[model samples]
Target: MEMRAPEEIEIGQDITPPILPLAFTLSDSSLHSHCSSCFHPLNPKIPKPKPNNSHNPVPIPCNSHCNSSLLYCSHHCRHADADLHVSSGECHLFLQSDTSTWPSELSQLRLALRLFLCFQKLGFLSPEFLVSGRIGGLMSNREKFDIPGRIREGGRIMCLARRMRDGRFGNVVGESATDEMVLCLVLTNAVEVQVSEGRTIGVAVYGPGFSWFNHSCSPNASYRFSLTGFIGEPGSLEPGFRVTPCGEEGTFKAWNGDEDKLTNGSCKYGPKVMIRSIKSIKKGEEVCVAYADLLHPKMLRQSELWEKYRFVCCCDRCNSSPLTYVDRILQQNAANHSTCLDLDHSLCVEEAYRELTDCLDQAITEYMSSGNPESCCEMLEKMLIESSKTEQSQPLEPSPSNFKLHPLHHLSLNSYMTLASAYRIRALDSDSDKDNQLEAFELSRAGAAYSLLLAGATHHLFSSDSSLIAPAAHFWISAGESLMGLVKSSKWSSIIKKSSGFNLSSLLTQRSGKCLLLTELELGFVLRDGFDVVCKGFLACISRISPKVWPFLVHGLPYLKDINDPLDFSWLGMTARHEAQALIGGCECEGVAYIEEETIWKGLVLFALHCLLYGGYLTSVCYGPHCYLIGHVRNLLYGGEGSSLSENVENIC
Candidate 1:
């Protein structure tokens, strides 16, 4: 079965009405901070002794029976979900005498339990659905999986889930393989509900209208979650209008919108899903969404899809011969020439690449888990320096120093994001003593630079492929925020004061209103212009300003010192012609005409604002205006000369 557009769908238009899930569960990590029923952020601050990365959630009324059982943001949410929660037998997992001993991986088990109870209530266990391995309009993929570890885990969960009536409060859940089937279905169909970057709160499984949509590496549609009450978003498309399920002849039975009997069920505050077109879709054409991230290389994507969904992706992007330029850039060894990666790489290049990637990945992972910023900074910078080596005199033997990852390499992109975050954390951890103040200042500066470079590097790739717009939106907004933070730093106050002659008060005042409505900007970016047009204008404008400000952003950062131009990646070329590829020829700050510190910051202000504007435009397309992400971007771009970046910054973090 697949989903097809019922009418012509324009880019950025909603493809489906907000549809409720058949079952869902808040991830164990998210249970304490987000409402169990609705996934709403909770209330009251529980200040930690140490500085923390995530926002302090507001607390709300929690579970009464057992504090560890579930959390709800409001009485209505609890009221809405109580019956389903109680009957699903999940409440027993936390109410038992061994409540404190519940497995940390209880989320999947709980989700599967909910599916079992809900389907049972809907009388959806008929042999007809089971024979096809698709129950409740969702694929079980039961036959696709044969791994012993998974089979053992599923058996264990089935045993533990036996609850009341059958395995009730005093007893423990499997009956005639229902639990096994539902667990497999959960594994096959659940979509992670990610509300923010690097944050996935839970998982949800929707019905036919959503589940039938196929996978595409180059997808035309994208989906976002709306975690709201029984009443979904105001002005949301009503059901049965935008899309229709295209069930294959004699292969899968189409749902006759046959879920009427299940309509009276509860969980009023469950998350709703709506799919939108990232690319235009014509009536009767199939609409697809990416089942996995698109940025992964073809091999990684195929491996992941096979492991999880049991199918190899033959999407056009994955099947392209000679490989697409974007794919080439993502996996290329930049130290090598613009040569094809045939059956083999030079012994030196291949080994160096493997060692460096492993080393870089390990450093990044350690930093995230341990928050050891200084060590992370040291290790990543060393790897970056190693990766950028350009010497034909290089030894034929394998060595870390000989390996290279271009700025646009996916791994390099990961390092940039980690470094940007690590530097900010290092700044946050520094003391206020005068000796450390300068260090903190540089740390902040480095963070902002990494963020900007990330945006620029990704923007360069985005100029080639408009489909990268989602990630492009995120990077640009992040860069804008970092720059805004830098400009407001006390370290810049004295310099900026002296450069009052370089005031952007006019821009701040004139564009404040227009910032909120992207259509009003001079570029009229996302709304009034095609992506190709915006890409050209953005790249041209950013390039002209990069030389003046890039050095200032990368100052004191060794990893970034050699990057003469962040937005123009032509500088990243083969080892033999490295000198010829040197456009700025080392840092441009020393060679370019002298500009005042104040003028440099003025340039930063202009740079940051345009990035935010461009990011905001891209975001409007990727996440429609009603999304919280769009609201956050609007607030970031709403500032004027007198406004503080902090005022709106908190909304995102």
Candidate 2:
């Protein structure tokens, strides 16, 4: 089944209204931090770190008398979720001390329990939910994962929930067929509920309005979750969308629950998902959204989709004859001194595809689980530079002659993002020490360099694929943040003043013409210019300003010294399309040279403003101006961090 556009849809237009989840759950990790219902932060007073990583999942507990780890952010949230929580037997499942369940499975398990209870209450246990290969009109995909072990576990969990509710604990077998179906349905259709700031707090299973949209490598649509959204009317925003099952006309199915019962607001409190067109769509075109990370190469994307969704994506991007340019660059590796490792699909599988991802992931996970940023920085840098592969024969000394990752390789991108964050945290750890301020400033400088590199490299790829705009927006905003942060540092001003006879304070205090230039640019005008024009100007601006500060940005960072230019990815030399870049006199031959600190300050500031403006523009197109990234950008340009979006959105222009 797939959903088709009812009418021609322009970019950024909503394809679906804010659809409420039929069943939802928070993972065990966020149990204490976020609300069990709306998934809001439990304590706004605690400083939340600027969002960097995109997929951090956590757990939450319901606000009930049950002995569960679930917590609520507010009394209102708790009240709204009361019937769904306590009456659904979900409050009982969390009370179990089953430390044996894998953390990854905990979310689906809890959600399956919640969904089963709701299904029973709503009389959805009929063939519509149980016997058919569908649950509440969403594909169950039970056949793919209905192994005896999975079914047994599902039944065991189902019985456990019952036992917990009845104040008893025992190993007893019960009617588990329906429970297994619920688990399979959730595993098949649940989408992660990621917040505006890019944290995956929970999962939600929506009806056919969203679940019917099929998967694609280069999708025309994308979705976001709004926890504070009010579900006043179901299907009220029904546009011209219709669901077609197997290319045949089929009635668009919505949950037929009583309006009064639904409007009572028992199940409307969870995150509400809104689907928007990321690309222009024709009236009859089938709307598609990515089910897996689009940044992944074809092999990994296929692997992920098959593993999670039980199907291969036959999208044009996936079926490209010689592999898409983006896919080629993603898998390209530098072996034996800057030589591209050209591997076909067979070789990619044989190579185990980025054997270093496991090692790099371990280093990153260790840092995330523990609070040692310095160690993480050292470990990631060594892994990226050395590109080590551990052999069972010689685990310590002998080299296996492994290949280094291409800058745009998924692993390399992950490493750069982690390094940028780790370095930022390292700088913050020492920012309070007066004596170590210069060292901290250097760390900040390095962090900013990686952020710039990440943004430029990703944007360079975004030129080939418009679908990458979502992530490109994030990288650009993050880059502007790191750069502007360094430029605003008092320590930065002191160093520039002492070394180059200029105080950056004037730039801050004089209310410079730069502010006027930024505010004068309207968002509507930006979208009118189209992404291509904005991208062209953005790359040109970065190329012009970055050379002056590149050396200074990477002054003390050994890992970054090798890259000649961040934006000029002409090194790949994949296609002649780069001829357009010649108009800007591409910075491929940029020499590593630093000017005085004062000049560096000016260059960094100019570079940061361009990044922020361009980044904000792309973000508005992808996630809208009201996104959390816009607020961060707004706060940097004006000191209006916590102001309402309506009041401050105009300044974003």
Candidate 3:
């Protein structure tokens, strides 16, 4: 859909039209949580009163084949879909095993079986519904999966097809319609059902008309998933998909509330996908939806598209170079409506890092808890203004010159984390006004992005000094805490409304966990690197903090070997201490050397300690017990140094 020049739009504007899934299946993980017929969540439509909680009604199942496992929103919807997919004998295959334990890949197989059943129900295949261009198009790994070998493993599919061929479903014989073609169609055309930003609830196959929309990395359009309200009328007794009212508790829970509920005396909700515009589209432009996450780095975005969708992204954003200091300075000045007469792009890398580091140092000094809040805010603003210019900068190739500095560089990472922490502290400041909280939230949001980007995708950071680990871990923990704060803030409702139909809260909450895991993984490496002298106290403190981090450390140590570095300490062996130790090194026993270094077990303590400390810090705001726990850990880490840990905890609370 295209628009004229005067037609301007903003984020969250519905893109004129919406599309519905042609055939959908719940993910194995979500099957137990949602009804099998209408795909509505299995949770109750209205909250049961406290008095009736113990007498809550049980849901009716689909059929004997899905008695305990499959559920429906209503008997009508259950019966409506029963003749098509479930009763046709496909549902029995899923029922034989524990449905909840099914692996994710089985979704594709399930979708294939359902499509075949739907075709049989219609008595014939419709040409309009089939995708053209090629067989198994855009489905990666077709060479391995889409084989004549399909028939070798066709016993179950053949059996199911035979059962569904009971004179009513097109009278199709066993050899009449092969399973390979149906499997190919499902594999090539299945669209992921995204329930929230960066999260998929299930996979669905759409009519060819719906699948024809092209993909874009910087898509002007976006989509959201919901349930169709009812069949035709509000109180009509017609059988259709049912939707539970969306509540205010979560972004997706409640509905618009304008529709009548008792229509048809049945609750019907079917899966619906609505496409909306994030930006205005000009006349003659194509409508697009992002097939992959836009938040991922360009290389990842392009690589996944190439591998999965068989295309390369030459999107403007991908083709463009990262913003340099000069580019940013000019943009910022232009946004401020300030003069840019002295613009210069000749800044070298060393000079750039030096300036950024100096700006960060000054900001850190002013960011102290002892400083005035106003002064600290000003300093933080300046620090962010300078450092964020580098936040998205990446080189085509890493070299020792200006291109070498990634966002994860010590100077940039520290600056971003410091600014983010300061903003969060101000946002939660007891004496601060609402305006301060708003501004703090904005800064926190941006800072958290940079922080997360640095830790996770900045692969270059993995080769840097071991000393950088502690600060990086601290930064990631701060990012997670700030995200949790946003999740709990009142501002979230408005944020959701303006979020281009994406679930901002869910995205942030998911990212918070990712940040924590990244922190744990990084600290695992740190503990392994500094096993003996440097990590002893850290390890001991952690064992008391939480014992859970130890297992992760034990499993994650081998991957943390800094394989990108030429001087990796682990595989290359640390410097020898004594002649006797070297001389008596090892007598080979079953292909193992008896030579000993510091016990790897000690590193487990250090890893667990930091994980506990960081985990506690992230939860300190609402979990008062964790507040005390983090406070103790902070005091343990810096007993006589200062009140940094306590101040951080206080700010978070």
Candidate 4:
């Protein structure tokens, strides 16, 4: 049953026994009835006759004799002896002195009567009072009366009427006599009923300002009802239970499974019940919940718990060093971000296959080096899947029906290309059969790599710059030509797509501008070599194709001054001189061709010096005169002596 406030309450009449008049002798030697402690008159002052024995001891008034001695009849003496009456340490009343201080004897009596009513409400007292001998010449009664109404009106009664009954009143009489009186009254008025079944035990719903309870993560109490055992699975509840009433609802649950498991259980309190740390707390530290999970991280916990609850936490877990805390977090972050490797790197494959496989492995490793571990693992797994498909195809035997290149085919192709280039250069200088076979295999591998690179380049063309396409085209053409020179016809047709399908026209057009510039530079060297080979005459081919190649030659002449190789420059210089003289003889009869003439003359001078810098080989027909012409051209290009051009020319010479 729900505990509710009593609508009405009754107090029985005082059952105190009548005080027997004491015959006492005062200092005057007169016999009189008086209080033993206060020495006050025992009878009311209304009309009692004086005692006949004038020689008896004189009676002293209790009011006049009451002093600092605790034995006196003052309320202070009752307070001093309060500790003796309580069994559980000091009474709550003594601790709450400011609220318990009574303004008068009547007020003190009223509080005591309230306490008696509370005990009666709790069923700790009988309805009838067990009175004893009384003092102050009064008889006391504890029979039934209107307890609630009398208490309500007791505050207005004067001293005579209040003192006429028991010396106790029924109303609080101090400034501090506010809600505590009402709270006590309410508590004492409610009847406690017991429930036998259900998850909930007893619940106390406090009004506003009653949520000041603190929390303990390892709580001291579990919820229990008055009649039933603690509400939980069997064995969860322990005997001899006592609740601290100081923690949060969750805190209680943390201690008991039944309470802990319920989502919207009866225990619904405010954030005040949350327990927060007052200092830094480290991970893995035993966390103590103040108001249960009231406060979270220490930074927030300290500000909130102190500001709201006014308590500082000194728990050991809340005092972790900052450096240690940071290091622990960083370690955790690293662990959470690591990738797991599954494939064994020791697996065997042919040399070409291994090179490609290694490239794929390196790419996978780099991609997974930073980020979430699960993502890195996924990426590496994909790489391994691709590696497995392509690691077996490079041997001399043909592949089976199930064979396929790895999905990470691009990375493998790039690796193959790099290795083939290295082998090709190596084979050019080595004479061993092993080297020759290796070079042949490398050329075939390079052809395959170029095919793969071209496919990727085609896919990237729309998204990337046109310049990127040139490398793919150049490498493919070079590799195809190399494979045609080395491999059998059957293999060449398979690896090299027919030149018809490939857009050679588009490729050549795209390369024309850059090719023209390169050829012009190469031609200047070929001329100094006296046109010994068609390769050296590559510039003449450019000039035959179009006169537009002439401008690139003029632009490249200034850069030739810094060339370090005398032989290379000398070859280039002779080629340039021949080309210039040919252009001059063709255009000399037309005065309108002077602009072309000046460009031809500059190319000639640049080429002549290039030839003279090295040991110029001479023909018998024009040997002496050629040397004289070379010397004359060098002096003119360098400017008169002691000038910047002469200085540069001298440095080169």
Candidate 5:
């Protein structure tokens, strides 16, 4: 519960259970569709009852005084929201006595106006309120406000001031001062409240304490909004490890409550926002949350941070690659083009990079426009197939440039990622079409496995940088999800059993050895100048796959745990130690006084290969440990350190 020292936090930790907004408004576009209080879908499951002889349709309140056609999940939410903000006469000023207001009008004015009304209602509207500094010194991007939209926002605030003076918003601060404070508050403290799946619901401001928490690309803390905090048996908490709330003793809810009323959604609590740590924090470490998606490529992350919060991120990920991985690729392509190769059989790396970028970009654009993942997959496959043809037509000359710009480059890896995402979607489709499901299942497995192989060669596991962790995790999660689907569907059960004669142990060993060679080359090419980008990818991959496999590997499904500790197979814990040692050049090979960087990299690669191979084996063996490859790899890695290969194989069989 107290994770001040470096520690591993489990997945789905309830950083913040659903909490009511302190000061919030529904997005103008979403007001008509979502609940005013909970901000969840208004009619997510239930349908409107059809008109009948004995039934009259209840009219939705979309008329006079309610300018926006707002809805709520229940009558309780409607009243709770009204009592909190609306009934305080804040919205009344916008809904004039005679004239109706448009949704756009509300959208433009809501944020600034809410700042005034909420403060006024709370009796904090004095001129000295700004000077007092009690309200955490309202922080906003004053410089960014002045750059582009300052005048426009200034004009809008002035207009709102006039409306307030003329309407029921009685005796708020003077127009100019009000505009200044509101602009500062909106720009600095407001947080976007979106649906759990990512649809923008609205913007809301948290309490001063919540606002003080800073942003980090690689964040240590996170929160989720809810109307009520969850209370259940300690072991039954939703996702994440069971964490005792900071002030609470052993458990959250005492046992005096009724047994039938202990569900997460049925709990009663207040509107305060809760925070939880995503990872361990040292005593002096800054606790930060990502303001944007941490998995985004670096350039995109930086651009959003600057555009939204007006601060350029200097986080480790941002610092590791200022140009972003994609931008660097583009730059490399351009630079390579400047010096054209003159050799007859030289397959120009620059040409391949350019073609791949252009083709993938176009394919992504088409997918975005059409919303068809299948079409996107087809386009990428076609590009790869065509590239294969070109590579065959002109056999590659083994120049450094050719080797650097091989067909199976990082760009090709990106293409594989895209294809994997598409097939994953197809595999998860709820539709009952058996042929489609079978095709999707097969494609998903191939796509995920190929992506993992490509991921291994990308220097993702070369070091323990947090930036690289996310992408690798994303790929592995995709692969694991697809593999789970295959195991459940039993599509490959017969094939797997029939292929028992295949020397899988040799195949895995050979593959892992090749992976190390490819990793050496990639490290030489991309990370020769910098090692910051190395193991972040591998760490991320393990982070994602660990919890998914934990139930099987750690808890061991009622059998293996009887013989082993539940914590013994923690890949994250193992890698964390490995990462720490590698950072300090602690790698030791036999007879070497000090291992060189190259040797250290070789050791790291072999370790990562083992992790990947074991991860795949565990996922596959979850079907039942009778699969022959599992024991082979286990014995190969842990032999003499534990039991013999024959003994382990006998146990499994």
Candidate 6:
């Protein structure tokens, strides 16, 4: 829809317009065409002569440019303009001039300034006419006319004058003069004259017509100054009445017949307007703005607005009570503390951590009471460090099953790893029962957790269909390093070896061997490029202690050929093949040297080869060739040019 223009005044039947132009002039002498007091064009018949006074009147020169339509002489003009006689109750005939009293001339001067300023601010004055009149009766004339009656009577006269000009009054009979008419009358009563800066020339006369706009602390219509003219609506200016509609029937109707006449039957109206959030209004409710500057905090804002506006606001922020304030303060403090910590000052870091711990405790209590798991989770992370430390030191025997681990201990792999390192460090420092037990417990737990992570991680690396094999392989390598640390730690070795024995043969028969073997396989795949060096070192150490467990080495060969997973498979396969060759080569040479030339050495060799192939004799044989040597015999068996027996016999010394 197109927006309407400003400067549009609605002239209803009861609406009244100002009859006199909002302009006037001042003079030094009893001017001819000028008013006796203001020195504008005065009505010739109604001469405002000076009152009799004991003091001699001072004579002042009149402006030469003024018209010479003489009523009063230059001497009278001078006496009337002088400050001495104008006060002293002697200027009654001169339109109530009392210069000695500040109210008399001072009020008029203020009124004139206001009118000039208004013209500067707003573009035009209302077109409706008003009658010239006086404000409150003079103290001397109070007994002559009833004060209230004069005010009421004067209001009625102005209303009639306005209605006559408008031609008709609308509906709603028996009402008082509208606010517009009342304003015009009030202006006439408070009219005054003013002089320019040097007092050499007169500027204009003005009145208090707009003063009836009232003083609302939370007023809706705001005034703004304009140099050109008033621009109404959003953009351009136009001619029409700027009426704000009322929702109720006859709610704005005039109270009296005189008022109705003044406004030409239009409803009583004032500058005080309402701005509502909705289009419709509710009964008995007064429209309002917040009355406070938007920048202030809620508490301060409400207090100031309530004191000045005399109404309590019910906004959501205002009604939130003290809890909101507390929460806001805490949040602000937290933000500030965090910023301080970011500077990396040690003191600030400690302080921030302490404050965060306190906040977490409070938040946890609140969240638990409210039964909000999400909020609880948020707080749990904040207190994770302290919680982990406390739980780790607590005795394990008496702990409840559900609460056996701290939240971090249960959830984060990092926490488990850290705990394991701490225990290992402490065990190295002290050999006490407490340290030993704690170390063993933590290491065992860490090992278990690492094992689970490694399984998931390695599966992703070695799975035939795995898409993220490269990245998974990288993760598996790192995980293997962590497990290797656990495997080689003095505390772990002491705990395991002391509890059991240094029997690789026996261990290979148990679940522990499978776990170790799987760990080795995964590590080999992860560190394929370094597998020969790492696996050779490991095997060499195991070989010196337990030579009987060589078959397990042979069993790992198939995994080398068939495993195409992206992890370091090549290095692992090559290392396995190299170890098999070494073991089989040792068996062939030794058996040929020790056995009699024909005493079934071939069967024994073949049996050793079979044992190497199947891993069945790994824990049984005490003195045998390296298990890897069997792979060479098998290769020879397959690659021999002639019969296997013929080639074997030729090779025998």
> Which segments of model 3 are wrong by more than 4 Å?
1-12, 43-57, 66-68, 95-104, 121-178, 196-199, 231-269, 312-405, 408-653
Q: Which lDDT value does model 3 have at 305?
A: 77
Order of candidate numbers by TM-score, starting with the best: 1, 2, 5, 3, 6, 4
Off by over 4 Å in 2: 44-63, 99-105, 166-174, 233-266, 336-354, 387-402, 494-526, 576-594, 641-653
Which ten-residue region of model 1 has the weakest summed lDDT?
576-585
lDDT of 1 at 122: 66
Candidate 6: where are CA atoms >4 Å away?
A: 1-236, 239-251, 254-290, 315-653
Q: Compared with the true structure, what per-residue lDDT tens digits does model 3 show for residues 43-148? A: 5654442343322223446665644366655666567666555544556555444333333366666776665665555433444223332221122223444344
Q: Largest TM-score belongs to which candidate?
A: 1
Tell me the lDDT of model 3 at 410: 44
C-alpha RMSD of candidate 6 = 39.5
lDDT of each residue in 1-653, candidate 1, tens digit only: 88788788888877666777888889989887787877877764644312442222444444545445476655556666666666676765555454334333678777877878777776777887678777866778877787745644554554454544245343222343666778778878888888865378998777766778899888888888876557644754554437776676443443556443222233345777788888888989889888986667777788888887878888878889977767777777765545634434566566766787788889978987887988998898888776664432331333334556667777788888888999888876763566687677788889989999888777766665666778888899898878876776667777556544224332344333323332233233344545554555555555656788888887767768877777766654422111212121121111222267766766677677668777877777777766767666556655334443323221100
Off by over 4 Å in 5: 1-21, 27-33, 44-67, 83-109, 123-125, 131-136, 147-184, 194-200, 224-273, 296-299, 315-369, 379-418, 424-463, 466-478, 488-653
Off by over 4 Å in 4: 1-410, 423-467, 484-653
Q: What is the TM-score (0 to 1) of candidate 5?
A: 0.53
Ranking by lDDT: 2, 1, 5, 3, 6, 4
Clashes of each: 12, 9, 18, 50, 14, 44
TM-score of every prediction relative to native: 0.84, 0.83, 0.43, 0.15, 0.53, 0.18
**TM-score (C-alpha) between model 6 and the true structure:** 0.18
Q: What C-alpha lDDT values do all the predictions have?
A: 0.67, 0.67, 0.41, 0.26, 0.43, 0.28
Model 2 lDDT tens row, 1-653? 77777668888766665677788888767767777777776654544423552212333235476777676654455567766766666777667676255335677877887777767767778864455577556667778873658656765776678667767777657666777778778878889888756888888887666677898899888877776544664444433333233342222333443333322222666887767777888888888888998888888999998878888889999999877888877875543222334455336533644467777888889998998988998888887766622221222321134454656677888888999999999888778898888888889988999999999888877888888878888898899889878976776667555533332222333222223223223232244445465566456556766777888888767668777678776655564123234222232212323656655666676677668777887777776656667777777655553432223221111
